[model samples]
Target: MPIFNQSIRRKIVGIALGLIVLMLVTSILSMVMSSQVGILLDELTNRYIPAYGHLARANIRSLERSVALRRMVMMKMQAPSEEEAYAARLREFEEADRKIDDEAEAARTLINAIIDDSRTPSDNAGLARIETRIETALTELRQAMNEDHAKLLKQVDDKQMTEVRGTLEHLDTLRDQFNQRIDTIRADMLKQVFASTRTVIGRQHQAIVISAIVTVLAAIVGFAFALLVSSGITRPVRLLLAGTREVEAGRFDKTITVSTQDEIGELAAAFNRMTEQLRHNERIRETFGRYIDPKVVQGLIDRPEVAIDGERRVMTIMFCDMSGFTSMSEGMTPRGLVRVMNHYFTVMSGPIRGNRGIIDKYIGDAIMSYWGPPFIEEDEQALLAGIAATEMVDQVPALQKQLPDLLGIRAMPAPCDLRIGIATGEVLTGSIGSELMMSFTVMGDAVNLASRLEAVNKVYGTRILISQATADAIGARLELREIDHLAVAGQSAPQPIFEVMARAGALTGAQDSLRAHYAEALAAYRARRFDEARAAFNAALEAVPGDGPSRTMLGRIAQFEAKPPEEGWDGAWRLEQK
Candidate 1:
């Protein structure tokens, strides 16, 4: 337990030293067991094998003596007496007899050596008993064979054939009995040899099993010790891991407790400090989150350079102003007006951020938002802006319903409506302000264009209007009606503006027919065919009676009939007011 308080280096060194000692113990124990097998092997090879060979030699010499006796009898019966051959046969017979005794003596001597050996196995006591039996049989066999040999030789010298034949048969009986005894003893010795071999193999297997068991036990003990020693170190690490997970889940308050006086404890202390700093940053983000969009706040907090270093990029900018905000505010008190405005902004703000557009600022009752690069992809900005404008338009009725409850009045003073303007063009985007303060906003012609488009909605009685660049970028995704080609206040070049009617598939059959008729009427009006344009415009009004673009175009056609434009005119109306 005290060891856990030690440094990591000491713990690692202790583990290494203990493992090395365990390895040495396993290896030494294996060697000691292996040496026992080696001793058994030596006894099996030297004692058992040699004794078996000597016994086998004795049996072979017995067979040789039988063959020699047969040759000596044949020599005595040979013609012309054959004294030389008979003498040679006699010598051969004696030599074989002597060899049997010599081989038996050698086997006995080897068996005696084994019995005397303290190093020999105790199980080999059976071999000593077997040796005694073999010795008794050999002694009896020798005495009987010597008597038979003398009697047979005397009978042959006296020329008594019948007695010699009977003696030969008796000698054969003795030989068979002796050979059977030797074979039985040899078989027993062979069994001992096999048993010794099996014992050696079994001991080898046992040694291996014991060594493996010791190794496994040592490993388990070492691992248990390491776990015990590292508990104080690891508990803090587990707390730190849980703390990191909490931070990932956006919870910055979790802190790890320091449990040790080592590096792990120091790490836990640093972790607590890091979480404290994150908590501070989180507070700043929450405070600023009210004035600015959370996305922009997070962007600036994480990557300051994106806002600090300005760049020019094509972005879709939107400006939404409440159409009846001034009149509505005039009817209500300041407190009621604030409630309505806050509620209105809250409803409009969701769709913009939901559609991946960043709300730049709120100018009085209007909201400014943009979509481009870090906020959304360049190609998707126009479409997202259009979708957001349509969503805001859809939210207006709900906002209208909530306004009476919000302001505590039953009858509405003025019907609240949204006038949205969307323009897509190149703009300078980043934090732009004086040294006193800073604001993350966009600038350039597009911002002014979007603002002007919002105002132009009043002229055409349209809820949402978008610049030519936006309509073109958006394509046919939104139901758009081409309103006019106008040069608004600051810009000289006229750009075709479109009115956002509804979502792509939201337009009714009447709306679709109106759009077709309006396109034809606008073409005819641009060509200066007043009569034909008037007819087409009247048809569009029939399809949708209160269609804004057709009514607006018809009014311009009446003015053209009164005073026609010059031949060089390009069907562009100019608005010189800001």
Candidate 2:
């Protein structure tokens, strides 16, 4: 153990010598046993296997000859003009007849070879028995069936249908006897093959067992020697590996113990220094990661060039602000306000992050986030944003209760709620700012529309609003109401906007009925059928009297009635102010 701490070269040389001796002994024993097994395999493959295959072929040929004879008879029964088919049948019968004897002779020859070969010990009696069986079976088949086959052919040639059928039956009986005898010989040959195979397997098994025992002994000796001789080197190596794994898992606090004054010890010391640097870098990342999304921070760190050169991509943007939060925070102390704000963001941020939306920034009481690749599936951006909005809305009741609790008060000074707006469109996304400072964010019409829609929530008295693109992307996954088609203050393209009611199945029976009537009312309003639109809106209000869209439409209809809308109104509400 003391010498193990000397030099790595001495330890490696000692391990190498031990392995060489064990491997040499193993190789010698394996070669000896493998030679014996090879002899047995040679006999089985060269003689026993071929003999068995020949016997099987003999049986198949006998069956073929019988079928060919019957086919000849059938062709004879055909019109006398069918000489061509009969001739073909005759050739097939002759071929089958020749192959039967050919296969029989092949088997006989292999069996004789096995009997004479003295290289591998075999059951001579069994080999001779198979040989005799092949001779007797072939002789008997040749004697009895040859004449019967001749009779069958002649009777068919003479168009003797009655005699042909009778002779065919008798020939079939004789053919079956030959096949049975052939089958018995085959069975015996198979037994001989198995016996030979078993002997080879026994040799192989002994070799494997002895080799395994030697291998186990070698492994035990090698591992014990390696651990003993390299204890000083490996222990430090193991500690370094553990430290590396810790660092890989993002925990940089662990440092490898430099246990010896060897090269491994020096490596371990260097590893500790590296880990400390990583720890410092990690602290920086954590400090900044809180201010920016981890993905954005990582993108800038891992691929600064790409992040700087922005790309245009479709994205779903959300602008969610706490309603009445300004008034709510005014009466509270600064510390209390911070506490309320932190709790508010914490409650609101979960749904956004939970649904895979990345928070871009928190501006005052508003949290801006976007959902798209590579954060989430591109097509699912709007749907995910919608689901997040609904989930955030669900968190409102809890926030309403907890804000006062967090402030250690009985109730809040003002009511708090969430107003969310989502828009889906193409946007330029990447790091955007002066060289002195930069922020990873998106800038485009979609971003502007999302902000304006958040403000638009106040005008419609709705909790959530989404642009036509967002609504279309969301499809029917979320329960949505068509609020109005309007071009916001900055954009000339009039886009339809809708309010996210809830999840698809959460709408009640009354809400379901109201949505249908609301759609009809909206269609009539767009058609400029003011009277029909008014009646449909009234019907929609009947389901839910306080429904905002219906009331909004009814008010618009009243204004239209007083003074007709301008020609080519397009039935779109264009916002004159943001």
Best by TM-score: 1
Q: lDDT per residue, candidate 2, 78-113, as tens digits?
A: 875467887899899999999999999998998898
Question: Model 1, 1-578: lDDT tens per residue?
Answer: 56766677887788788878888998899898888888878877887788888888888888889888988988887666688898898898889889988888878787777677776464556978878888898899989988998999898888788998999999999998999999999999889888888988888899999989998988888788777766766788889899999999999999887766677878888999999999998898888788888888877777798788988999999999998878878889889888888889999999998999899999999999999987678889999999999999999888889999987889679988999999999999789889999998889999999999999998888889999999999998889999889999988899899998888999999999989988998898888888999999999999999877778888988898888998899998999886
Prediction 1 global C-alpha lDDT:
0.88
Which ranges of candidate 2 are over 4 A from the true structure?
A: 1-227, 251-254, 408-410
- In model 2, state the lDDT of residue 125: 92
Model 1: number of backbone collisions: 0
RMSD of each: 9.3, 28.2
What do the candidate models score in CA lDDT, each in turn?
0.88, 0.88
